[model samples]
Target: MEKFEQIFKYVNEYAEKLVEANGLDYLEALLQTLEDTLDGTFEWQVEGANKEDMRKAIQIAILKGMRKSAQPNHQMTPDTLGLLVAHFVEQCFEHRLQHGPIAVVDPALGTGNLLFTVMNALNGNVEATGVEVDDLLIRLAAATGDLIEQPVTLFRQDALEKLLVDPVDAVICDLPVGYYPNEEVALDFELCASEGMSYAHHLFIEQSMNYTKDGGFAFFLIPANLFESEQAKQLHKFIKGHAWIQAVIQLPENLFASKAHEKSILILQKHSEHLKAPREVLLAKVPNMSNREALAMFFEKVSMWREGNDQKR
Candidate 1:
């Protein structure tokens, strides 16, 4: 094999080795079934050398692994997403991770990336609730919950609705957004931007702002456009009137499942008595167009922010 081919094979082998070490018996069983399926598919297609069949097998492996790995979100790279989420959640819940339990919520649970990552990071110090409008996603989240042997209370509700009234200790959401306004609303935000309202994604952030407990924190990943758009400006103007906007992390492009648009993660503290140092937006050019590395850079910065705050306190 060529050097590149050898490296690729090694990577795959190393991944399976890690899975073998970390996975439970149930996960092993599921992986076995998936392996059988892949073997059959590859054997059938090898005669004709059908590339599409190979792709299907890859998808099947991903789907099965996701289900077995307690992932509910389809088209998601759990390892990369989990690493990013767990990193930020650590910063957000470093204090609360000590207590018996705290309230955390993911408005757009998308296959439970934020939800499950938080669960793993906190090591179960938190009780979570997630809401997703997609039935397939809901089912996936439910299956992951079962696999993890935890109650990740999830609801089928629109994230763009008026209010979540009940306060939560932490909020993390990756609001869906596209280049066009209509695409943004229909995909993730789900609410129309009216005369008085700004835009759907921004609305999701604002509503989450209200749901976060006094002094609690919220982490949101929204399109970069939301920060520069006239709508975002007006919304920021309104937001400046209340709460502390701790920091904004501008992620590298293609950091999400879509791997197209660039987004930013904003940390907002709700009903807080104190204001932060007003951090300038941190910009990282995503070292290698890698979503995982980009997200890692994000929470690493967040950790720095938290440490600085701790020193001041």
Candidate 2:
């Protein structure tokens, strides 16, 4: 097993045990446990840190037992949001350690994972704001920001109805695939997810694009259905003519805690000369590891994507 794998195993075990032992929910215990066990060590502070030390840090988080990070009645936190957050952070770091945009937004930020993850990635540069209707999710997310000691703002508002007046530099999100949905078609989420016959899971992809600052990047974890077909072609035309489609990463089913194994990562930048839409979709097997491992692998892949077979637009 790899070094980070050991750490992740410890964290997961600790998280699960703590949740069961203390009768806390998974997301509630995560931030506090993570904060205690793993100090916010930047890339530079991690100089020459051996694998064993990394493993120990994870253990410490586990041994810390419990803290005040849990929230009551949080909704839609069934591990999907955690995985999405991990994926977004991977892309943020893969972008050469440079915070692409100041204002980062996620319209359907379930449990604030997307915002929190980007906050983790940007470390401070990216000002994140997430809009969710659930008050419980909002409170928990706010608590998570406090635990991480980073300000990840969350708003209890309808994303579809209210748009940010301020300009957005980059927008990253993982939209719902429409399992349980509202009736309003004009809702920003439905408008974005409408890909004809079965809504695309990561429908926020377009909303993120529409609001993203010019030349900023748009990264999303979505199904392969968005890759090909005439619908995809038309969408591609809309994006290609306006923005630079950075990379299309095809992932396995394990990428998220979903039944559908069909998955992929779509990277888009608003009009950039540095990146070009990939003609051949890059394939990647989803790591069967925990959410953290999946995220680590995703970030590692972002670095790989930057170096691998790519075209200059």
Candidate 3:
């Protein structure tokens, strides 16, 4: 086995032992054990190994364990797509890094995979925070934060009802893809009645906007029905009124490699009175390609569009 794989195996075994002894959750045990083991140069067989790098790899191991145990309803974004979303955020907000650390939030932070990648892409030029309604996922996110040595504040609260004390620089997430189970929770959303089949994604999008500063960005991975169904027209109108739709990229079916459903990434900038909304939005359909190739193409086209070049396809 590869050296990193060896590290993962050892870490998993240690975490499992901790779970058995202390009756702790898998993620909690994994993180507690890893903190002791990953102090400095670890897995030296891997060239130029550092503590943080090893921690990142171990975090992935914990993520895999979580994914394996995840219920079908969890709706976690695949790691590759999470990386793509992070890349998009980094590219779009790279200029803001010069001013100060950009504050970013994921209202539906599942395992914090999206935040982790975004932090890496922006070279730590971010103050990352998230809210997760799931106890398991929130604990997992906290553990992942410890493993990666990334300081992320995660709140265990309903994303829709959570109040934002301060507006942030950007809001990004793979919005949960189903109806809110609790009607009381659903009632608080702006378009609760007209959100059609699923209110989670739309409501979270609205909540994200609420916490975003004027001229700040919000990105979401949502079902394609959001752009199709007649019920969503109101939501679209609301979006147009409140923000500028920067780009809508129709992702390939099976982009997540399971269920084979078509989804789109909506990149929106909250409207500011000082700046007029663009006359036209960039719309592109991503072709089937390896994740690396697809994300590279995406970043390239978006960079061009932001530079005032009209990007076609």
Candidate 4:
């Protein structure tokens, strides 16, 4: 752990230097520093470091840069939450893992942190795709993928815009919440608001499900009041028509600054004749993340649920 801290410190310092020297944004500077470090342009020697450790090192540096920037849209998914999502992915998609490499996409791929975290946890047996509109973020995501030697294809465009990529086995995203600005674009979506701006998160869910192969799963970190909003009735109807709700795991409220900001992981499987809805939705409230015994019990319940769910397939 000390060695990991040292690596993070080195990266953070170098990134800060670049930010000052080149008058660049912290995230851009951080990207350049990571690229330079990998190319031997930077003199940091990381001996006996595994890929996951190296990735975490970079992630920590990026987190600091994000704090310095303080942009709400630039928020990276917290590592704890990312790891939990990865665990759910591994458990739910165990059958796909047994067969071969699985393809995954993140529509709101900010900094690629959540996507890469899941990819690394899967031991790199993944075909990853990320969509982002920000130039710096897409570049950072691409560079981070190169540094980690993970093959990730990225698209630089509005995530809600028409995607050219093919459908994948699974979809994962920390859904970008708020109103989507393009009212014209929103009109094309089934979940578009009848009289006002549509929720981007709702539209993203629709878009994600569209790109997913039949019977594929989508794991989304959605707002806690997802079903309590004014547009939720339409959203609920759309979902019922298209997919099966597998689970809704409420994250610990303490993770956020306030109750209103709390989020939950919603797991949905696209509708297919071969796949039946789970006998019961796995609705759960996570305990404080520091409680190891509680967390263990929680996952044990997940394991038992998975076993029973598999029998239905």
Best by TM-score: 4
Per-residue alpha-carbon lDDT of candidate 2 for residues 137-195, written as tens digits (9 for 90 to 100):
56545654564566656778756554753547666666555432443533444333343
**Candidate 3 residue runs with Cα over 4 Å from true position:** 1-6, 18-47, 50-56, 67-70, 73-75, 194-198, 258-260, 291-298, 309-313
C-alpha lDDT (0 to 100) for residue 215 of candidate 2: 65
The superposed Cα distance between candidate 2 and the true structure at residue 48, in angstroms, equals: 19
Candidate 3's residue-wise lDDT over 175-292, tens digit each?
7766666677667666575533446677788888889998889988887767666547768877877888888888777565554366788989898866666656779877666677
As for TM-score, the candidate ahead, 1 or 2, is 1
Global lDDT scores for all candidate models: 0.58, 0.55, 0.72, 0.89
Candidate 4 overall Cα lDDT vs. reference? 0.89
lDDT of 4 by residue, 1-313 (tens): 5666768878888888998899988888888897897789986766776767777887888777778886778788988889989999999888779888889999999889999999989987789999999887888888888877889999999989899879998999999999999999889899989897999999999999999999999999999999999989999999999999999999998899998889999999999888778887899988888999999999999988887886256
lDDT winner, 3 or 4: 4
> How would the candidate models be sorted by lDDT, starting from the highest?
4, 3, 1, 2
Give all candidate RMSDs, comma-separated: 10.6, 8.4, 4.2, 1.4
In model 1, the runs with Cα more than 4 Å from the true position are: 1-79, 162-165, 178-198, 254-260, 274-302, 310-313
